[model samples]
Target: MTILLALDDTDSLESRGTGRLARAVADAIAKHYPIWGVTRHQLYVHPSIPYTSHNSCAVIHIDADGGEPLNTALSIAEKTMLDDFVEGSDPGLAGATLDQVAPAVIAFGRDAQQMVLTQERARTLAANLGIWLKGLGGTQDGVIGAMAGLGLAATRNDGRFLQKGTIRSLTGPTPAELLLGAGVDEIMTLDGRRVTEGTIILKEGKAAKACPINGRVVLFVDEQDGKLVAVKRN
Candidate 1:
């Protein structure tokens, strides 16, 4: 089962951010189900928005088998946000089974990136889709961005990984298969063209990013130092 667990707010300027808490949720659930790591989606950061800092939300993907229940993960997120979030933070948690997410909810994500969204609209869409939405403290305004984050992430071509598990730095031309084994989904150029799985492409001692592009976590590379070295997408 593929799940998108998104969170927003959940922090103060002087405290730990929501991304940390989102990873904590993924770590806790890893004991039972396999975690695909968490992707960070930058929400609308405008003068009209009241954000602690960078207005980014996170969605951790979990591919579960018949073994563990999904509630186990949601419980971890709820308790962690309630306990670890800074005082006065309005932490919102939104969860969706991607296969079941509606078109409206997905559209909500695109809207959020372009303009300010209301908590009321977010709640209505979550209710219609039967998504799990909750707020921990403060005004609960975070519910808007929380659901929006999940929606945007479901686009499958929107953001970069906020925290992928044990991503080691590359020293030279590692095999493309090796990079895929480390959680990358594709090898591509800046133009989104696929690169063949041969020794010609090397990692070249750079940090690789698993960008969500066309429903895949693609590794983008460019010509650096006369060789194609792996690069990250912003």
Candidate 2:
């Protein structure tokens, strides 16, 4: 009955929003089930995202941006098939059915520039976890719902590098991989539409296109192939 809240970073909405939501869900579960512990992890897309842990009976992935956090949350809920209510039972007891209890909450966010979860992948996660679905709505109330959202009420950052041309690409490996290989950099995205050099001030994957700035530096480039790939900054 431990709840793991894996976040990308402390700066993003996943940290603030999903962190709050995890707290709320933990609160509700505490009332009926004995929560073992709640943990959070910052995630990155490079080196490939880690599969939800085996210890996690349920997981929630929240994108740094808006829409996907809710969508991912709902997908996890559905996969876990979390019950809204459980009969008087000790969740800590062996062989205890996780009735109305979400075993884990996998909250996602940004590490460098990579978006970790995808819509199709989220739906697949739900199928794997075996939980019900519910969106984590926007607002304080929605935050509360994200925590409590399992029942029904459950409503539910990083840096720069360089720019080349209209199609600027990192001249190395993927951001995350580059970090492992080299270190870090102050790489920024160049506006293709405006042709202005701008850094990513704010970002969210689901809302990437809608961001005021042009394309973000979610991936690096293969200096050889001239293709976008993951890279470490610096």
Residues 1-234 of candidate 1 have per-residue lDDT tens digits of 688788986467766887777878878878877887688887888888778777888888888632235677788888877778677788899887887577788788888888988889999888877788998788898898899888888888788876665554544667776776776777787766677665324455535666787766777888666666777565
* lDDT of predicted model 2: 0.26
Q: What lDDT score belongs to each candidate, Candidate 1 first?
A: 0.77, 0.26
Flag regions of model 2 displaced more than 4 Å.
1-16, 45-115, 138-234
Record all residue pairs in model 1 with backbone atoms less than 3 Å apart, i.e. clashing.
Answer: none
User: Which numbered prediction scores highest in TM-score against the true structure?
Assistant: 1
In terms of lDDT, the best-performing candidate is: 1
Residue 96 shift from truth in candidate 2, angstroms: 13
Tell me the spans in candidate 1 whose CA falls farther than 4 Å from its real position. 65-68, 168-178, 191-207
Q: How well does each candidate superpose onto the true structure, as a TM-score?
A: 0.84, 0.26
